[model samples]
Target: MAAMWLLRTLLPLAPFARRMRHGMTLGVRAIAIGADRRVLLVRHTYSPGWHLPGGGVDVGETAVEAARRELLEETNTRAIGPLELHGVFFNPPVGGRDHVVCFRVPRFEMGPLPAPTYEIAEVGAFLIDALPETVTPATHRRLQEVASGAAPDDCW
Candidate 1:
């Protein structure tokens, strides 16, 4: 948790720190809706509110690979089938060149929840009809899009 806090504090300086790097940055988020009709969400140590389990896509990692990795790392869950690409949205508020790829993890198995880590603070399977009020707006929007079968928005 302290590590993430430090990273969050240093986040604004990241643009300058990464000025040497070229091109856009990519991230992955996994959206898992269970047979019980609940959506999996996670709270991060560095950020406020609940969000889809995810993180940055490493230098050579594919988005789906990142999604599966993050889902297990953050929530002790594993995808058991193909993950469908939901959307790729520009996340300008996070960074000028940051874009997040969302995936629907339709077939997954959740192990017992892992204890909180430096990255993840908590995890929950929230009912579709009773989402937490503190869910991040972007996450909430994504959940709505999934629930309504609506086209995804361009922004994240």
Candidate 2:
């Protein structure tokens, strides 16, 4: 039991160590806007509130590929059309060396909404003007940037 606890406790440090060695880490987030003009958001079990579907970029995967994969995994939605790059933002809260590439998915095909998972508690599309109150501040800022035609800020 002590061994398991120790392993769990030290696991998070793995990413920091990897960042120190690799120099940087990258993640991807996708903004899937449906025909109704609603943007898809996810409520994660591991994290609080609603957020755009996204995850870390794997060793051999491009940012676009990671965004596509995260959308499908977190929302059961596939980006069937072109994914436009929104911006690359430095995610300071996660880490100074942690960066996130944002993509705007204008067209997609969703296989029915996903059920709750250990990673994702819920997934749904919401209007830009009426985001849920529990939505993460970062998420809200990102969406607001999208809605108002504002350029993505360099920092997240």
Candidate 3:
């Protein structure tokens, strides 16, 4: 448990670690939608775009578990039912081929949204047609795919 806590605490340094590693890493992203069709998005302290709530998969954790954990930590939300696997994408955001597993939380319980922290700057749920202008292109694409039932691209 202590080891996991340490890993979570040092997660912000993952990008630097990725630059030194020679293999692909697995990460997870959650598409948490409410009953009214609004989707949750978060802005990070280090990044400039609004993105789905998620993070890197731990060494012994499954992608779904990582997605769930990230959603709970970032938005204080809990899935009320099974999560759907949206797709697996090869994301080259920081150079290496990092695969991100996208999950859809069709039903969930919302709690108080997280306050601004060292990692997350802001979080909110926005109507599908009224998303903020700063949303990441990849995140917008994923949302489109989810709405239209279109096939997702190989990359994120």
Task: Name the best candidate (by TM-score).
Answer: 1
Worst-scoring 10-residue span by lDDT in model 1: 16-25
lDDT of 3 by residue, 1-156 (tens): 999999998998898786668667888999988879899999999989999999999988988889999999998999777899999998887555789899999889999988999999999999987899999999999999998999999999
Model 1 ranges with Cα > 4 A deviation: 1-22
Please give, for residues 113-149, the per-residue lDDT of candidate 2 as tens digits: 9889888889988988889999998888889998899
TM-score of each: 0.86, 0.85, 0.85
Residue 124 miss distance in model 2 (angstroms)? 1.5
Model 3: how far is 90 from its true place, Å?
A: 0.7
Give the Å error, residue 135, model 1. Answer: 0.1
For every model shown, the clashing-pair count is 0, 0, 0
User: Whose lDDT is greatest here?
Assistant: 1
lDDT tens digits by residue: candidate 1, 43-76: 9999999999999998788999999999999999
* Alpha carbon deviation, residue 98, candidate 2 (Å): 0.4
